[model samples]
Target: MAEPSPPSFPPGNYDLSSVDLDDDRYEVKQSAIRNKYTIRDSTGNVVLRGKQKMFKMKEEFPFVTDNGEDAFTVKAGGIMDVTGNYAITDTGTSEEVIILGEDFSLFVENWTIRDPDTGEALATIQSKSGFSRPSDTLSPL
Candidate 1:
């Protein structure tokens, strides 16, 4: 008789392809100090987590997994960067993948998402004007 095979395991352990691209919704939980954030999928499964140290001159958020594996890192612009841009870097290569920056607009909140590698504009988020209040100025998708 042939020997029994070991139990099969899930493919792509912590691989990028293993991530569910279809699941867009994420449930977020933040610490009381707003320095730590826990992110979970819509099914209540922990997927990503982030932590930031307090009282830092420049903001840095290191996103990781529950088991303490580096996922990605986000470094915010210092006081000199007036546009309020943040760079998202890959954990392994430490290369900038995306550049997030805000656009200066009067009476509207505008944001621009770009690819740092190719310098291509990926998307733009613009808040509609005349919402009566700033809190409700977000434009519906």
Candidate 2:
């Protein structure tokens, strides 16, 4: 009897002419912008969520209110002390920003306001291009 042939793999000459490389071209474009600010207490509880604006120019970063009031300011080239927990979101870029406080308790205590979550200090809050506040002055997204 003739020897049985071994199993053969699929042929290499497959046709792929129907696949379109540029099919989904209308996806929403996202920009890189700092937009929203959310503060949480040490107990992992969210305390504050609002529209906080940051100004960054010439390597200096400062946190300000939506209407140009000083919320938090830091020196240029200095290390930023991020305390507690906070989240920042950029709607334009669809990026979720998170800041985790570290062992620098002294620095965080100095800048942040009273109240547990609010008491935590923020490090550098730099403003990227095309960042803006909403009309309601609540959240960035």
Candidate 3:
């Protein structure tokens, strides 16, 4: 598969350039007891950390940089995405930039990264080997 292009974001408070998207080898470590998670590089440097509020009618995860700057958020709310579809929004502008939705597969875990506006499939992510998808493009985003 070709490298999956990230979803386009309009001019707003959302800034992708501020993020360290240079490395795709970062690992995600989730807290077993809660919704908190930390993203670390292969060398074990914390990249980004985030958590969601408990007891919400809908699920949302807001992430921030190690320096504590708001980065982005993953939200599941709209009628069209209330089930397995999620919107990754820019926290500063509250604009939905991308979507992660569940796509059915017979044997393995299947999911997709999509454009929230056009509903175009940007990438198909499968659990080929525990997050070892063919392309590591989506990791830093």
Candidate 4:
């Protein structure tokens, strides 16, 4: 079967200039054992860091800033949950940003991000083959 054409957006319809840019670029470095990950910037300055510890029941990974301030955390859920089942929370306000779940199909595997409060889908990401080109425009779901 022929593949569907990629979606397109008209020119000047969206303003790309006013979008906020991330000033600090983070580079993640993981240890050989995958127990620790350090985030550094372009100048080799540590910006954020994370550490994980193994346990019998559950495992939790917390990411912190250079000053040892709590940034966010990821905690594993029960085994009965889906593949991407985990709880991710922001440490500052104690708000959950994204709860991930996986959906499998015959041709694609989808990773969905849902709102923790209402359980509504916020975004869906699908794995694509390396030879496939990305669409130039994005539309709201």
TM-score of each: 0.58, 0.19, 0.65, 0.50
Model 2, range 38-116, lDDT digits (tens) per residue? 4334444433333323543322233333344333322222222223333332233323222333233222222221222
Model with the higher TM-score, candidate 2 or 4: 4
Worst 10 contiguous positions by lDDT, candidate 3: 132-141
> Once model 3 is optimally superposed onto the true structure by TM-score, how far is the C-alpha of residue 123 displaced, in angstroms?
2.0
Best-to-worst order by lDDT is 3, 1, 4, 2
Error of 4 at 61 (Å): 2.6
Candidate 3 local lDDT, 1-141, one digit each (tens): 886564554444234544655554556655654558898887888878998676555667788888998888877755323237878887766778778886544344467877778987766666544443322222211
Candidate 3 structure lDDT: 0.65
Tens digit of per-residue lDDT, candidate 1, span 1-141: 984333332353222322342454556665644457788887898888887775555667788866677877878777334347778776866777678886754465677777675657766665434332332222110
The per-prediction tally of clashing pairs is: 0, 1, 0, 0
Model 1 TM-score, all chains together? 0.58
Model 3 residue 132 distance off true place after TM-score fit, in angstroms: 15
Which run of 10 residues does model 1 get worst, by summed lDDT?
Answer: 132-141
Error of 4 at 51 (Å): 1.0
Over 4 Å off, model 2: 1-32, 43-55, 59-71, 78-141
Can you list the residue pairs that collide in candidate 4?
A: none
How much is 40 displaced in model 1, in angstroms? 1.9
Clash pairs for candidate 3: none
- How accurate locally, in lDDT, is each candidate? 0.61, 0.30, 0.65, 0.56
**3 or 4: which has the higher TM-score?**
3
Q: Report the poorest 10 consecutive residues by lDDT, candidate 2.
A: 20-29
- On TM-score, the candidate that comes out on top is 3
